[model samples]
Target: MNNILRAKNLGKVYRVGKIDIHAVRGVNLDVEKGEFVSIVGPSGCGKSTLLHLMGGMAKPTTGKVFIEGTDLSMISDGERAKIRRDKIGFVFQRFNLFSALNSQQNLEIAMQICHNGNIDHQRIKEIMKLVGLENKLQHKPLELSMGEQQRVAIARALVNNPLLILADEPTGNLDSANSYKVLYLLKDLNRNLGQTIVLITHNQEASKIADRKIEMKDGMIISLS
Candidate 1:
């Protein structure tokens, strides 16, 4: 299979006052097409930083990242933004839904972002139904439970039919039951739809669902299995 995502010599450094902290250190990885990969570690181990770099949300201090053969570090900011909007869907730890908008409207906004204001209501309904949110389309974020809110967020991510989904602690805020629901939804997307996914999490259950598990510690990948 071709590589959907690749990072070579990836690194990130943060400067705080007089102190320089290395967040990632010369890490290298490749995610094959249709593969579901997990990055797991304790806090401050650079899992999130690595995810950001791979997703083109943050530039690496050194080396390169390529998404579907496009070198992210070589692209202009506008081009990178376009790639993110059209090719990548992100599910953040926070639901990040607009509290004022209903579930359908929230997904419509994402469609608009992806399609440059040509909202596709039919596609929105399709993705909502896929995520089991068709019944709650009119519910606002405040009206839904945490699990429902996360489902909406996942639906928003899927509305664009992105080639890659980057999830950062997607179930971090949910209880065990809700977390399992979210994880199973992701697994279903991979197993059934063949969606490429790179997930960052501290939850062992979340990581166990992945096809491969990579353990990171102190800014380096310690083991990959």
Candidate 2:
């Protein structure tokens, strides 16, 4: 299979007063197409930062990230933004849904921003059913439970048919039962829809659901198996 994402000698440093805080240091990673991979680490180990870099939301201080053989470092910001809009989807732990909009409206807004056509209501219905939110489409974020809101976020991420899904601490805000529900849904997307996913989380049990698990510490990937 082709490698959908690659990071070579990636590094990011933050200058705080006289001290340098190395968030990610000389890391290398490759994620294959249609693979479900998880990055697990303690807090402040740069897992989320790494996901941002991989998704083209942030530029690395050094090294390169390639998406489907295109060098991200060489691309213009607009080009990267286009790639992000069309090829990548993001689900955050906070379930970044708009408080003012209902679930279907939120997804429609995302489709508009991404310039996505084929906005079939039937497909939207299917996704809603897939995430177990068929009855909650007209509800606002505040009206739903945490799990339901997160599922809406997932539906919005899938609306564009993105090549890669980058989830950062997707279940962090949920209880154990809800966490498993979300994780199972993500794994189902990977297994059934063949979605390539790179998930960052601190939960070891959640990480174990991935096809491959990578452990990071002190700004470096310590192990992968």
Candidate 3:
């Protein structure tokens, strides 16, 4: 299908005892295959909440999330988990790598969980090469720079060759130079490999790397360009 993801009137509401806090409201979105789209917004504007809903990490309180034409709200939690593992690759702001595991091992765990089958060593190597971390495969998180660690995280995400990648501020911990490099790497993956990506960021300059930019505020999308 041309659209890898679709959200229909999606909403998420948190019950804080006496009050209901609406995080996402009436969001309708379509993400085409191989498109690099970024969701940009200020803190507390519901960008992360929206991403969580899209990734199937959190179920929406209202409406539905359709991934590869499958309705998330209609499926069981286990089914949704399977879809998250097999179809969506998530890159978070924190590297989230195991402290003791080397870059290669970190990726191996992800592959093991998602593939639920034989590990593909060649695929792992290719993804490491793609992220320019072939040499650092044996190094643990402490041995690598923040940018390299993030690169390892990215490589881990790509190892599965998923239908879509959801990166949530993957460069948030880096310096300007590292952020620039990471952003371009994502851009290159999208351009050369036709990797579909949806990134969430509050940095306006960083959001420019995306093919499409979506702005959100007050629990809703304000603009998409």
TM-score to native of every candidate shown: 0.98, 0.96, 0.98
Please report the TM-score between candidate 1 and the true structure: 0.98
User: Relative to the true structure, how large is the alpha-carbon lDDT of every model?
Assistant: 0.92, 0.93, 0.93
For model 3, the run of ten residues with the poorest summed lDDT: 114-123
- What residue pairs are clashing in model 1? none
lDDT (10s digit) by residue, model 3, range 127-153 = 999999999889999999999999999
Each candidate's number of clashing pairs is 0, 0, 0
Candidate 1 lDDT tens digits, 1-225 = 388898999999999999989999989999998999999999999999999998889999999999988999999999999989998999999989999999999998888888879988888888989989888999999999999999999999888999999999999999999999999999999999999999999877689999999999999999999
**Regions more than 4 Å wrong, model 1:** none
Error of 3 at 2 (Å): 0.1
State the lDDT of candidate 2 residue by residue for 29-88, as single tens digits. Answer: 999999999999999999998998999989999899999999999999999999998899
Q: Is candidate 1 or candidate 2 better by TM-score?
A: 1
True lDDT of residue 26, candidate 1: 89
What C-alpha RMSD separates each model from the true structure? 0.9, 1.3, 0.9
